[model samples]
Target chain A: MEVAAFYGFSALAILAALFILFSKNLIYGAFALLLAFLGIAALFVLAGADFLGVAQIMIYVGGILVLLMFGIMLTQRASQQDGPSRHNRVEVPITRRLWGFAIGIGIVGVLAKIIFSANFRMSGDAVSRKSTIKTIGVELMTSHLLPFEIAAILLLVALIGAAYLALNRNPAQ
Target chain B: MSAISIYHYLIVAAILFATGLAVAITKRHFVGILLGIELMLNAVNLNLVAFSRYDSDRLSGQLFALFVMVVAAAEVTVALAIVLRVYGHFKTVDPDKLDELKR
Candidate 1:
């Protein structure tokens, strides 16, 4: 039963990811990415990483995707006529595409080989265990406090920096 | 076939990474490249969380994934702001036309 759920969620995640990749419209792609994020959060739940899953949904789907959409909306005019022309130019050299493909495939192949060869034993029964939010809180505040605080600081800085950058007015005006 | 393995996640991540590369290469819009970068970042996060699941060191991967998420958020914010400024200045977001900086 759990296995089936895992496969279901994994399939959903992969499909959403593909949509995010292939979708031509930037807004549609961001929406697709939201679906992907939700699907992966489900996968995280199936894997018993409940806290991470919830955070994934909240931060990624809820917050970041919205920010991305806002960015897209704010930067581009709404007329559909402008969208295609803005994206129509062939900027990348053909050789760069070939190089990117070669590098991506090569990296994937190498990583796959390395992962398959390693003996990955499941350490505990965490898969079956419930990852209550309480445990995550305790863990975050305890041994992982430094990183937790750092992440908070990072977020604060990001917020301030984003606001500053986005709000900057033109001096030449 | 019977179960989802780590390799399965890896494969998904690989495909995602490849597609991101494709998007980055083919898309001329600055935001399009940003979207591709987001996809790649999510791929890495997926891999990290998957391994954290199977490994004994609980929460390490999850912790790192959280950091990655925060950083990605920061990156997008700054990048989009830059994109906005670029658009304001250039009147277009196409990378090909932004070659004034190339020399």
Candidate 2:
């Protein structure tokens, strides 16, 4: 069951990413990215990082994906002419091999085989699996307090900067 | 041996990262680049969370991944704002077409 779930979600992630790569339509690609994020979140859960998985769904799928879709829609061509040219096609020709992606997978596979077998675990040190929310909350309030504050500041700054940047439209107005 | 290991996770991450790289490289639109970057970041997070299993007690990896998620969120807001501003200025989002510095 664990193995099946692992491979299934893994495949979901990879395929969603590939769909985003191949799909020329920006809107469709963004939706595909949603799938990819979900798959990643599931993988996190399967790995026993329960809290992180839920956070992944809330943040990436909820916040970032929406922002991406907005970006795609806001920048669309308003020209009256209707044709394939206006369908949000990317630079990739249909015949493109996606070799870079293939190469990346190949390289990582080779390295994993040669440099790191990643088979053995510290049997004695293996911790019992449990809900990570308490641990995460405790850590966030304790040792991670400083970085937590910093991240809050970063989000505030980003929010203000984005709002300010996007406020003004036509210079003539 | 367990049905799944760190090796499986690593392979998945690799494929994701590679696909992201390809997406970034092949896609001409600026937003496509952003999409690619997002994928690559997610791939890295997967790696971190997977290895984080080793330190499940400390949850060092998960915390790191959390920080990464925070950064990614901040990044996307700023990037999309910039993209919107650029679209307003250049009237096009194609990176290749926007060759000149000034209109």
Top-scoring candidate (DockQ): 2
Q: Residue A40 in candidate 1 has what lDDT?
A: 76
Q: Could you tell me how far off, in angstroms, the CA of residue A153 lies in candidate 1 after the best superposition?
A: 2.0
Task: For model 1, give the interface RMSD.
Answer: 3.3
Q: What CA root-mean-square deviation does each model show from the true structure?
A: 3.4, 2.7
Query: Candidate 2's residue-wise lDDT over A6-82, tens digit each?
Result: 88999999999999987878888999999999999999998889999999999999999999988888888888349
> Model 1 misses residue B75 by how many Å?
1.9
Q: TM-score for all predictions?
A: 0.83, 0.90
Give i-RMS (Å) per prediction. 3.3, 2.4
Assess each prediction's global lDDT (C-alpha) against the native: 0.73, 0.85
Over 4 Å off, model 1: A77-103, A121-126, A171-173, B1-3, B55-57
Q: Residue by residue across A1-173, what tens digits does model 1's lDDT show?
A: 86778777767767776665555566777777777777778877765677778888888887778877777777764444565555333345567667756766777777677777877776653453655466557778888899888888887887888788777598876
